[model samples]
Target: MTEHATAVAALTPAIADGPQTIKVIISGGFAAVYRDMLPEFERSTGISVETGSGASEGAGPKTIRHQLANGTKADVVILSREGLHKLNEDGRIRAGSEAGLATAPLAAAVRTGSRKPDIGNDVALRKALIDAGQVVAPSSTSGQYVRDKVFPRLNLPDTVRLTLEARGTEAAEALRAGKANLSIGPTSELVQESGIEVVGLLPPDLQLVQTFTAAIVSDAQAPEAAKRLIDFLSLDSDILLAAIKRAGMERPRG
Candidate 1:
């Protein structure tokens, strides 16, 4: 049998055994592809999905780590490797149940119809940041990289503004609302939003290709169904992975 079929067959029993719904809390890093492929997973396994959004890496209440600690119900949690590592360290993820989902590089975007800046090189990217009065970013892994690492390298003046939002899509919204001149986050999240124009990946030296991962939460209510969900996402199915690539993310690299 084909790999995909074999994977699906393993989960068929769960559908008959009892409840078939699995709760998932995911960050935007993997949300694009997940949303794209979810219907097929449900069709194959007869499992229903209930999903919500969270941030992958941040101290805020929106982070998966924080929510899980606060008694959020999630059979599966999708987030950055950094956040997963933290969950793992804290024993929040079920041991040996993690699967890598996809990777996406940080990118810049401006409100559609705005002047696009040249950020192809380090110097040009620096100037672009300065030229734009304020740059908006999310509180995810990519934003932390910019706030913690990239800005220090540029050493721009205090006059440059930085507006941070709780999520990547919100950062895009900030740009669309004229709250900032540019937004930065995973390419997969912002590139698909209307009224947003992606400038491109950050200059090579400053680029971060964040790995998004999926794992069963330790307190998952539907462990078997959650495993099946992870299988469908990571089985390397061309139809889904191709859609992921077309949506501005790369297949996850081990």
Candidate 2:
């Protein structure tokens, strides 16, 4: 048998009998790709998957941390590396089971049919932000990165108006509602919204790439199945790499 097929065959023994169901709690960054690839996983392994999604940040009860704290049942959890590490420290997930999945770069967008601004360099980006009437950003990783890191580096805070939304999608939502002229968040979130036209990734010097990780929950009822699902999502295969790309994320690099 081919090496890939052989490896997949070896995982069959880990599949629970009689059509198992695996529960997953995931953050927004990786949600689109996971949802897209789940059907294939079910077809190949005869396992049904259930998923719950929430913002990666915010103090709302809908965040993944809040859900877990409320005693949500999750066989697997996918979130930012920092978040996963915190969860691991809290004894929520199995130690050493966390695996890096993908990285998503921050991107900017404008409402559909709006003139795309020039943000190709530090100077141009600063000018664009300064010139914008209003800017929208998520209250999570990328937003914090921009507010703390990029703004200080640029030294032009008061130049642009800023609004922080609860979720990444809310950034685009603000733009769609005409409440803001610019929206910034992970590329995965920006690209999925129909009312916003993503300009491009932020310039390399000012960009923040959020790394997402997956782990089996500590008290999972289906740890083996969860591990298999994590393996299937890994970039070890070209098929998954394509899916990641299509979902607007890149494979994690060393």
Candidate 3:
């Protein structure tokens, strides 16, 4: 067998037999990438993944401070560096298990037929947000990044209105319903929405390049399976990796 096949064989001994179902809680920005790859992952490994993505409130709390404050459970966690660090500090996950998964720049999306606006600069971004009647963003790391950093830098605090504070898919849904004129969140979140058009990524100079990290929970029921899922998600050769990039996200790296 080829070296790659040999490696797979070596890892198979750790695979549990009863069910390949892995319960995972993913947040921050990587959730979209994982969700997109689920079907392919299942087809290849016969493993099932149950995933839920959200902001601080959805995941646990606004900061790792809250995730630690209120105990949350899952086989795996995918969140921002800050969030992961808090989890690590609280002993929620293994110290070294945390690894950078992907980097996504904040992006903007408008309704498919609406006039696409320029968010290339702080001024334009502020105008875009203000112009929109309503906006959707999570209270997660990304939301915090925008609320805490970008908005202040742009000087558009009073102009934009936050319509909803949901997590993951819910943020996208807000955009779809016309409840919000624009959806300002991670690229992964914007890309998953079928009803809206992704205008473009926030300019590099002002971009919040969020680095998402994944960690195996401290006492997972299927630690081996969880590790495999993490490995599969992190694999460079996996088509899902490409899909993540296609969705405008950087691939996970050690």
Candidate 4:
């Protein structure tokens, strides 16, 4: 068994009587990895996890902020650090319970079989945008970053034809449907769709890395189970690291 599984197995017996269910509301940024790890957690802890999705950015009603505002019964939440901080301030999350999970960089993707465009440098990226017919971007963290920061920096705010989608997957879907020639969002989101070929991460100079974090909900119905889930995921094991990498994220540094 993997070291992470071994560790979880060793710890499972101690929480034999803990809550049997954990409900988590997580942003799309880390959804793939969290889902990938759920079965292992259930096997080790005997606790079932129910997950819900939310966008990491935007003030839309479906965003995590709105879910917490409407009193979603979340035992745990995983979202961008900024969003977590807002929850902490609003007394939605337990203070001091936050833990950094992974960092995902922005990436560019094209429909499968499309000629990969060069985005190796600022100049090439600018040219790629200028030459593309339609560009799709999520109206979330990475998209906001590109819209508010990168576009102005590139001095092509009005040059590129941009289509903004409510979520990352939508942006990828637009690319797959031929609605857009290029799509940009978190690498994790881009990698989740099968019909698109991820060109690569944006050039380092233009890259925006978003850090995802997890925390126990302040009024969680299963606080102990939630804390245990956080602890299990925070364990720096090879299995966890590999899963993060496969989900297009990197382990955060100390």
Candidate 5:
């Protein structure tokens, strides 16, 4: 069997008849953090989770919608707060089941072994952008924040040309390739990929917190298991929040 098949095979025994297995489609943003903790969750409850990564913002919700449109299976989803809310409004996710998981701030990251930029103050921040030949960032959320907020505030709209990556990790890849002097995105997304040093968060005055939320789908195959996953995300020990922080997120207030 292939590696993915092997993973699914390992999970089959834990899938119960009544609770069944929770078919989860999660954002690539959260996958790395939560992947390490799945075994413990499955071991404790006899619940199996199948996760998907890649895509960002509305991408996960759109995938869920296409699946639902075609009658594919999905019990839960974790993605940007805005996406979850949109899904709930569209009846793709259960309205009452939506839960906020964690919030990640936008940050600038430099490639490993590259010269670090000064993002400390408005003036220094402007100079750094002008000095860098190119920059890569997402078109959504973080990208909007920088283009709409950061650049204008720093008076450097003309300094750095922003390359809007379709996915958050793509910016990190740009940084690794040296195609761009800087990569900026959700801190969680930035920290996951190798070959980058998170320069530090954009100063609080310039930062935007993108909340990541999770929800149990109304048509979930395993409602109980789905709820279990939701509960795990809310708890402090689940590592979702920690991973977000480790990836560069700020601690959220309850």
Candidate 6:
């Protein structure tokens, strides 16, 4: 039997007779891989996945934590590890269900046809950011990383513009509109924008290898199914790696 077939067989003891769907609330980080792999998961396990999108971290109702607090129903959540930590702090996630899915390196982008920023080294990236004048980043973990670490380490003066976008799409939109000269976010998110072209990942010193995690909600409607879904995502295999690569992500590093 194939590896997928064996895993499905092992996971099937809990599956019921009829149609079953598990509602999932996920931030942008894991959505691409999840969306790409969901159909196969469903086909193998006879489980339907209902997905919802939100930022992993931010100050508004659009964040996963905010939605969960405001009574957004979900069995599972997929979001940045930082956001998952918050959910755990809030006592919203089931104990010990957290699983790391994949990690993506922070990337930089410029408007289509614009000059690609020099990101060959830490010094080059710092100079690029300074020369660009303004940078737009999503108001999620990646944005927070920029605010707390990347910007400060580079000593970008307050005069250099910085804006927190609500989502990667918004950050990319800002570049497309020429409102900003650069954007920094996960490669997965940046690749989705058609009006922008990625320059390259941030220099190694400034990179944020954001890990996307999956966990069952504390009040999940289908806890077993949630566990199964998380397992499907977390377990490494040829197919899973292929899906992650397709989404511009990779297996989480130790």
Could you say which candidate leads in lDDT?
Answer: 6
Question: Residues 102-214, candidate 5, lDDT per residue (tens digit)?
Answer: 67877788888888888886676777788885888876557766777887777664557888776676777888998899887887888788999888777777778887777
Candidate 3 stretches greater than 4 Å from native: 1-13, 16-20, 56-72, 252-254
What is the lDDT for 246 in model 2?
A: 79
Tens-place lDDT digits, model 3, residues 103-143: 88888888788899998876777788888857777777777
- Residue range 1-254, candidate 6, lDDT tens digits: 44854585686467564557899998888787888778877887777888988899988988999999999999999999999999999999999898899989999999989988789898899888988998999999999999889998988877688899988788889989989999999998888679999899888878889899999999998887778788888777788788788768998777
Against the reference, the lDDT scores of all candidates come to: 0.85, 0.81, 0.71, 0.84, 0.69, 0.87
True-structure lDDT of candidate 3: 0.71
Checking candidate 4 for backbone clashes, the offending pairs are: none
> Which ranking of candidates, highest TM-score first?
1, 4, 6, 2, 3, 5
TM-scores of the candidates in the order shown = 0.94, 0.91, 0.82, 0.93, 0.81, 0.93
Q: Which pairs clash inside model 2?
A: none
List, residue by residue over 71-90, the lDDT tens digit for candidate 4: 77898999888778777778
lDDT of 1 by residue, 16-126 (tens): 575488999999888878888887777766789999889987887988888998988999999999989999998899999988878888889988998999999889888
- 140-228 per-residue lDDT for model 2 (tens digits): 77787888888889888665777888787777889999999888888878877898898877899999889988999899998888887
**Residue 254 of model 4, lDDT score:** 75
In model 3, the worst 10-residue window by lDDT is 1-10
- C-alpha lDDT (0 to 100) for residue 74 of candidate 3: 72
